[model samples]
Target: MAGILAWFWNERFWLPHNVTWADLQSTEEAAFPQAEDLYLAFPLAFCIFMIRLLFERFIAKPCALGLKVQANGPQKAQPNAILEKVFTAITKQPDEKRLEGLSKQLDWDVRSIQRWFRQRRNQEKPSTLTKFCESMWRFTFYLYIFTYGVRFLKKAPWLWNTRQCWNGYPYQDFGIMFTHHIVTVTLITFSYVTNLTRVGTLTLCLHDAADVVLEAAKMANYCKCQKLSDLLFLTFAIVFIVSRLGIYPLWILNTTLFELYEALGNFPALWVFNILLVILQILHCFWSYLIIKAAYKAIAKGKAGKWNPLHVAKDDRSDIESSSDEEETVPRSKAPHSSISTNGTGGANGTNGYLTGGTCSEEH
Candidate 1:
């Protein structure tokens, strides 16, 4: 396969040159200046090329198979299509009326319309899995570019100097550390008060989980601050979990168990303590909700930042179209209204007279 490809490439670009194959081989030997070196390097280069070709053909090809092709050879479609499809499906329904309308509008069969809806429903959205994988791949590619490309550009002083600042921070700043601490403590406290220790613990765990992702993202840029962030998150998780679940629970259980041996006269205090414990547990649950909400917002904003405005516009358009379709299918009804009137003259004097209102007015 390599020979075939090489032959095609030779014919396409090399054979047109006046140089003969023997002359090219001689030139290659001259450039290396050592037969043993040439022998080793030639086979190594060939093996590397073969591996890369196989990877592109087998792995990358399969992964990209379902992506839409562009006009210029096979390329993935613009990101807007995926976003549009999701929003469109969400805004519109697969009702008989809307499906029939779509069928008539597109000149497709009603069965085909139904099939299309099913296909769309079955088709996966741009899931977190795919997005995460793609981002990692891009980050890996950028790392390579920064590593080797920087070394190559070093020969050109201007280019090297221009990109010198590509290096990221060595350590996370105090601000980030402080924020993490605040968030962890606040979430823990909230969880304890709301009686949602489990949920709060999960929230803390997610913060730790996000550190892994954030570290990977920083690694793409060859940033060393990732370790600091990782350590901070890990510390927060450990401290929060141990304190809330371990230490606190142990203390409560020990007190309650010991109090069982106390006199019945102390029962009222024990009951009050139990009540407070329940309240604390409830507060902890509320705290957990806040933590989850905050984490979700943070991740969502980060992802949203990467999306193109054009993609967002496409999503908005799909939503509008879907909403319009739904409105067309839905039956409209008038809302009931009330009315009132006032007489110019008073009933028995020169005062103004009042007429009973519609629904608001009641008979004596």
Candidate 2:
């Protein structure tokens, strides 16, 4: 009787204060021996951290190493000092006004300036694989905290043991799980159809190139940074296109397959439903194309070079022509002209007339 009373007191008061895996397991073992399976449930925080770490170490790090090699390697050589200068300038002038001033001095277009500003404001703007890995590390740290909160609620004996927890309330958890499953499956399908994995890999390369360009812009008094930012923007645009065109169709196909399986007994009804879904999917594809087209047009305007996927073109010719055109089109105001008029009559006879001469002018 004493042990039972003590256990009840511990569960109500002490359990809440010292909530841990061990404490949760002990409570489950003592109160509901048959419910031992629940005690084995790991915290969501653990899973999130583990996944984040794995992605950072396995995926992001390798990409960063490859980028470093490319940047330093013989094929494309860039001065280290120039790169450092550009990065330093960006870091020092983190504000938009400073960026604008820098852009004007560098002769970069507004679109490039906007892109640089956007990147600076983002919490995780990874230009290198190393930086990406670091960002992932930070993201995982925050994700762990978020998961910890969820796990806390799940593990709380007071909540889980209550009758209110089991009846109909668990539906919310089911809904969340279902949504997560759907999103994950959709993303996976999108990855396969759009070849997003390949694009994502390319993005890492583009990001590195942008970083180098950013660095170059800072060193020289030019709009070179704008070109880098534009490249990054273009990469994002391509990724968006892939997601829309490739992924959406796969999603429709998946949904159709599901409906077919669900309505096996009612073939005609399933056929009609499938047809409607197909129409809706086609509409969705059209809408996605419109959005992608608009975005592509917007980003393309800021491009500095040929922007051909299969070609290596330089921006030098266009840049030189634009610079020359700017010089000719924007007229320089002539320096203010100063005029003076003086008259002297009969200086020898000044004693008699006492003539004086003065000059006056209006200033505008």
Candidate 3:
């Protein structure tokens, strides 16, 4: 197999200046990155948290305070009841139809209706604590998601490779794995959208959650402290590798590919599932390849500073895209509050409540 692959590669690559095979092998070994002890990430994350505390206290806050950026403060902005009702209605659904309804109800012009609603929407925006909590929760979630990815799946056979998970037939179904994936995906979408308002309510919770916390932390960077991005990418990358790249393939991919076959055989439905799962693995490898390129570029350029945290996107578009079928267009209820801000004076992250995060994350 190795000989076949090498011959195939040699033919395909058609080496520059007709470089010899031994020379290529030596170059490959020399260029390979040394593995770092991932355990060191725990303390490194702590150090990052401390750096955030100081930066917020000394830098972000002071700058905001100096610029006098607090608008309307924590105290609620009072509008008359009639106008308040009109205003609240618009913020909930900012549309011409809703504005017209308020105009007809309040006997106001459409222009007047629009103006009051706009002012009120801006004014009623949640407290900084609301935004802080939102970002903080998201930051925590990303970390948790990464950690969770590593935990249950690590012990399973497939972590090492795809072929292992299917070695035996009719494997026992672990109740926890089934519950976790469905529940966690639901929670992340809900959390991302809801935090746009203020933390609302929660009936149940997931055991562990980063994509969450790093989000909150970056939202804080909206104060023009964009350096937070590098710190977050660094902190989150370690756990992301163990969980996303580490266990997910072995656990989810293997089961979907090999193990499921034992129970379902080669049914059309099973084949459909298998094909999609294989496609997903192909995408994962492609994304990982892109991430590797980004890492090499980060090092080649001076932007990486002294640290190089190889990133893994956990930006599973398939999972997210699938959720769209389950989630509603507009949530019937206001989401759990962790206030989201799109204001330039407020922060540099998010489109409404969904932070675009950064160029790196968005690419995935």
Order of all candidates by TM-score, from best down to worst? 3, 2, 1
Estimate, for each residue in 26-115, the C-alpha lDDT of model 3 and write its tens digit. 242242111122244456677757766775666555544554443233223335597676555544324545644554565544433333
For model 3, the superposed segments whose C-alpha errors exceed 4 Å read 1-78, 88-115, 173-219, 222-224, 230-264, 271-364
lDDT of 1 by residue, 1-364 (tens): 9999676435223221232334323242242111132244456656656755565456544444433211122112223353346438673335545544544455544433333333343233332223333434433433443344335434533232322211111110111111112222333443232222222232333223323333243222122233443343334334444444454445443333343224122323334445555565565445444433433453566531221211211222111111112212221222221001012231123122212111100000
Which residue pairs in candidate 2 collide?
64-129
Best by TM-score: 3
lDDT of 2 by residue, 59-127 (tens): 756754654411121111122343235555664223445433544554543333333332232213222
Model 2: how far residue 341 lies from native, Å: 43
Structural similarity to truth (TM-score) of each candidate: 0.23, 0.24, 0.38
Residue 229 local lDDT, model 3:
52
lDDT of each: 0.33, 0.33, 0.39
Selected candidate, larger TM-score, 1 vs 2: 2
Deviation of model 3 at 230, angstroms: 5.6
lDDT: worst 10-residue window of model 1: 355-364
